[model samples]
Target: MTSPHRPASHGIPRPRVWAPLHYPGFATLFIGYSVSSLGNGMSAVAVAWLAIELAHGHGAGLLIGEAVAAYTLPGVLVALGASRVLKCLDPRLIILVDAIFRAVSLALIAGLALTDTLSPILYVSLLGCSSLFGLLGIAGDLAATTELLPSELHVAANSLNSVTSFSASIGGPAVAGVLIAALGPGLVFAIDAATYVLLAGAVLASRRYQPPTPIVKSSSAGIRDGLRALWRFPALGAITLLCVIFYGLYGPVEVAVPLYVSSVLHASASVLGGYWTVFALGATLDALGATSIQRFGLWRMTIAAVAAWGVCLIPLGFTTSAVIGFIAMSVGGLVYGPFIPLKKTIIQRSAPGELLTQVAAASGVFTVSASPVGAALGGPLVAALGARATLAFSGLATVTTALVAVAVLLAYRRRTRKLSGDR
Candidate 1:
């Protein structure tokens, strides 16, 4: 039986469920995220392909990695700055600008690839575009968490938002990979550009959510306070710390997987994209079962799923075929559903209303930082140790991290219970 204290579950239907705290604003965000995730999936595909081209075409490993750096490094530097401006701009306007800039960036990448003009100058432009996109995302996050809802539906809003990306991860890359193979990178990039157009259209259609307050603060003290709250507040701090560990392990798994397939497994490019499609589909399926996941124990299950994900990687190291690798990734993706939402809910619940965006942006910033670091380390590690050994070692590290997280959470929970009893 469920505990009396469980949050109300919104019964929508099998595979199509809702949270009781649902608001119409989340629906808008959900539509936007789904479309945006498709675009994101394509952009990521382009980046990895771009990396591969740079490394092999010019035989420069650092050059390829550097190209991708334009995408990630700026998120770390600009997250706080974005949080400050997020308070001033209309969230929708920010998203529109973000989409436009990113679409232009994709067009630039395609132009460079098509005309044979790929250059360091182009990479710098990619960096600038990525920075703008990151800021826009921070604004969207804050707007989703606080400005969108009035009466404490933060957890549900976050979960629904998660569902959108989950869906896009399933469909976008699978198709893009095929398109990239059939038509080339330019078509894939154009598809992403179209996705942004659709996303802007979706935002235009949604009616219910408007920013409740204008957040034009005179000083960015609000940004500073958000960072301070993360450290000062125990729950938010703990969740953030654990999530950092999760993402650190998760980084190489997603970012480096394509590189692994081509370089190590000797798989075709089409197969690599399909592998991600399978993984994303699994994640989507996992999200569908959120209601069941809650009753069974969210924390313990997240721990087990993540650890199992690590264990799955061990077998992936032995796989010679792309089919085997895709199967392995899909199995890992099965756990991804509950894992992401549980992590997000932990933060949304822990963060206070006023500082929600800053907290969310901080989380994004941390993820942004850890992923590249993991990839940077993984890339050379793959080059040095070979794919199988590097994967095995990464797998072990992930398991170790999960074990530490479980122990930490258990200790904290026990102490909290004791205090409650004492009171």
Candidate 2:
């Protein structure tokens, strides 16, 4: 990566922002992004809790269930369109505008909370808008990952992003839960609103960047083309299957966790938040050593993440102790970064430059797009099947991911051998 300027060191720095031989913008942007992301974590819990209250004495977990659906449903349905939007706009502009968009959406949520007469319909709309903002957020992330790092350094860059994300995740839920319980959800929203100001400031301050990939010029058909491109790879068949299982299994646990704590453990809302923080901490730990994991190999990392995540789910599902469950949750979180980064790296490394963006968006279509359906299923499954069954379902999903990924890797290996022989 070419540095436009030398990095300015500040505050117990993690990496240089700029250097002729190194890229610090990746870390800098990710750090800023992590801060905003932490605020988002807080907002999400607060929003879920607030929505539960609006459900008028229903279990707060139920509201979390619906909120998950409302937020992720759009990601599935609109990703193709979002891909097209990215095609037409500059990545930097998109990043800047998205910051504003998120800020507005967050402010709206806080405003509603403060009115003391907040309506259910209004809350739903604002929450829905936040999800749409997230759609853009993911697009911006793909752009940053592509523009900021040289291909060879993807693992290190991804590790940084994972750490930043996990750190924020660890802090957001615990803080949000406490703030909501003590001062009410409105204050959580207020804090979130301020973070947006900080987020926008960070983006605005960034050095200018634009990708070198040629434009596909098929903005209108970007989604159609993106979806169509999936057929070009047989591995995607298994990938899709794995994604369904993973999301289906895990989404319920997240949706149901708050209720499980409140009812089963007699924990306060603040305590519930702390429980989530533990889970995030586990994920952060994974990112901390991601550099070492990547040194082993991306394919190996994917397999490990899938298989370990599955086994971890078993203990997590059965554990009555929050501390024990959190320990398991942390393990699961560690597994999160390697697979995500590997997925992106694998796809980018394989595809031609101009097509990288579309391929990345295709991933969005696959991973997040399925989240709502998972959320929708989570509600009824939790209501009827119970948490253990739900947790078991997620474990099953992980097993499927591991099995399918191994199969695909073997097949790809065979294909490469055949091509080599022909040559």
Candidate 3:
């Protein structure tokens, strides 16, 4: 097998944005993942709208919160188990299994909705079931990217993945609004389910072009090994903690934004979809442009992005105009676009190759849980403070978190410099 890190000498100069697609294996996976991401993006809108329809009476906010949380929280447990049960499996197999299981679970939900037998309990339960492998799938995809490209291209590969999802966001919600209006959210979900099947096929096809290395069996230390790796790399631990805080703060927006559009703006689903579509449009544009600014350093880029995102979101809290909300979301998306790729790049560079999957999974356990936990809290916050106030509060708190991170990062740099002088 050729060295995964060996750069291909294809004398042809490709645009930086399209560089990653030059590799066959990564290209194949990227194409499949991009198609599936459109479905996921549609489901993002459909799932919340469906929950709102099912929720009734005073407890609606809490129920909506539970329904949204259900989609991702279950993955926390599955991710924990991955360290033990999934460590020996090939990354491509992990991706395939997740795609298959999610497809089936979502198909069941769609079927129940179409049959008029979908209760809130069943809907939430099935949503939870659909995401059981969510974290593992993410870890697998990252691991597979590492195997498919050299280290130098990993950042670009990660950016491409983010760009694909954001691009789907641009089209998916707009299309979903039309679909939901015409055929209802159930059909939209069915479409998403079909996309997963395509993703499974993509993973299978990639194996034919470039087979992944077999994972050697290791001592069954489980999540402990992953935790040890995090401990050994303080930077990873710090980055993971920042992600947990940042995502947790952002979670309330998931609950608040929908309510704000529905109740505050008194807008239809299309308007709500419009907000997301605009946000995604900005994100996609910024992500494509990110390669140009990477020389600034990932840590600096990440901090600045978070601070700017919080600032952008503050405008939404004060404005009731859908136009204003759209503007805020669009700016927010630009600031938020670089975050995932930058975070993933840091993890990829920081982690040991042997423990990449475990470290990703372990870090994922916290980062993944953060948003859901915040969403669960969002219900009560929205109920008590109103959606507008909740949006403002989340923004303020996120800004504070960024400031704390900045201070911590500066102090750490100073300490490191002092230690080097002593040495």
Worst 10 residues of 3 by lDDT: 1-10
Over 4 Å off, model 1:
1-23, 48-56, 59-63, 90-97, 107-120, 135-139, 142-160, 177-191, 204-220, 254-274, 296-298, 317-327, 383-385
TM-score of 2: 0.81
Better of 1 and 3 by TM-score: 3
Model 1: lDDT of residue 134 = 65
> Each prediction's Cα lDDT score?
0.65, 0.64, 0.82
Q: After superposition, how far is residue 218 of candidate 2 from its true place, in Å?
A: 4.6
Ranking by TM-score: 3, 2, 1
TM-score of 1: 0.79
Query: Cα lDDT for residue 126, model 3?
Result: 91
Pairs that collide in candidate 3 are none
Q: After superposition, how far is residue 65 of candidate 3 from its true place, in Å?
A: 4.3
Model 3 bad stretches (over 4 Å): 1-15, 48-66, 115-122, 258-272, 317-324, 382-389
Q: Estimate each model's TM-score.
A: 0.79, 0.81, 0.86
Between prediction 1 and prediction 2, which has the larger TM-score? 2
- Model 2, range 248-300, lDDT digits (tens) per residue? 56667766676667666666877666666666776777664655565556566
Backbone clashes in model 3: 0
